[model samples]
Target: MIGFMPMLSKELRELGSSLKILYIPIVFTLLTIMQPVTLKMLPTLLKDASNLPEGTIIQIPDPSVIDVMGSLLPKFGSLGSIIIILIIMGEIAGERASGVMAMVFAKPISYVGYFAAKLIAGSLLVIVSLFAGMIISSYYTEIMFDKVDWLDAMLGTLLYVPYILMTVAITLCCSAFMKSQVGAGGVAFVLYLVLTMVPQYLGSFFRKVSPSHLVDTASNVIMGVADTHIVAPLVGTLVLCSVFIAAGMLLLRRQEV
Candidate 1:
């Protein structure tokens, strides 16, 4: 626990030096803001661009706050997932490949502490970025559309965070085994797709088990739907994250570095 702080600080410093600390927020913020603004302006933009007759009208429905907020899940689930996987795929593998791990561990250090630090740091960054985007999105959504219930929106967004953490854990596990960042990224991406997308084609059982359920649960909150049973997916995600963390620690300990 004592060593976790410095290790976490090192991870944070690395993120800052790499400019991810600045740009990740920018990317997420844009993603959040883009949907509402574009939806709000779509009629005008389409009408202006179209070469239709003067009497022609572009009839577009005004999106509700729920629609606007609901759209964000898919945006984050797809692009945000990819970006995070790319950023974190190198967390441990790169260090090991570049001999940084050896140098760092030449002194007395806790392997479990190192692994915990990386997971917590990466997860923290993801949670912060996601919630920040959600907050901005909520504000914009209220202005452009109807007002969303703040408590529900906040609860839904918070519920969605474990899914992101699960992705980070998978990336860390892949990083523990792969020698290169590309390899780790590829493995993590494939696994993530399998976990989040392939389930869609399977039976209802698969839907219940997959991390994809997290999105559904969150959407229920955003849509003001009742009886969104989140316990199964939430528990599944926590278990997967724990398993991945344990696997990463085991793999890292066995590596020659």
Candidate 2:
């Protein structure tokens, strides 16, 4: 792990210089806040946009604060995943292409350190952005609906972090071995779909154990459901993240860069 801290600082500096530090949080915040705002305004929006006959009424009920908060994870899961892939898909592949990897490796850094730095930096960016968005969205949800429990919101967000971490690990793993950034992004996206979606068809057990299940667990947490079933999905997600990080490091070490 030689030069790990310096390497991490470099990665974070690059992210800031690239303005990902500015826009990612904004995008995620918008993605999260939109859920509650749209839900709150749905009835009015529908009524205004409709071409219905005169005196026709759209009577959609407003969602509760719990429901609004519970809906955030699914929104983040789909769009936020794509945003993460786009941001990290080029982290390794682009460096390798531009000969930056060779320059960086010329230092006393171990491949493990380099890989770990990338993983941590990317994960930090996404995790911070997610929490920023969640906090702001929670505030808006409370304002538009009812009061939200801070403890529940924070715990639910914490539970959802593993999914985001797994996303970074998978993207970096693809970037480490693939020569093309676009190819890495595509493959990562496909793998993301497979990992999140395929388990459902396999069995209830698989579905419950998959990383995607963590989103459901987080949603349940926000909704105040008292289930002890969170352990499997949480452990499964962390283990999956470790497997990908190890694989990425192994693949990176084999490369000429």
Q: Any idea how many clashes model 2 has?
A: 0
Q: How does candidate 2 score on lDDT? A: 0.91
Query: What are the Cα lDDT values of the candidates?
Result: 0.85, 0.91
- The TM-score obtained by model 1 is 0.94
**Total clashing residue pairs per candidate?**
0, 0
**lDDT tens digits by residue: candidate 2, 1-257:** 98899999999998899898889999999999999999989988888898889899788877878889899988878889999999999999999999988898998999999988999899999999999999999998998999999899999999999999998999999999999999999999999999999988998888888988999999989878786479999988898899999999999998787
Residue 239, model 1, lDDT: 80
Query: Residue by residue across 66-91, what tens digits does model 1's lDDT show?
Result: 88888777667878888889879999
- Report the Cα lDDT for candidate 1: 0.85
Looking at model 1, the pairs that clash are none
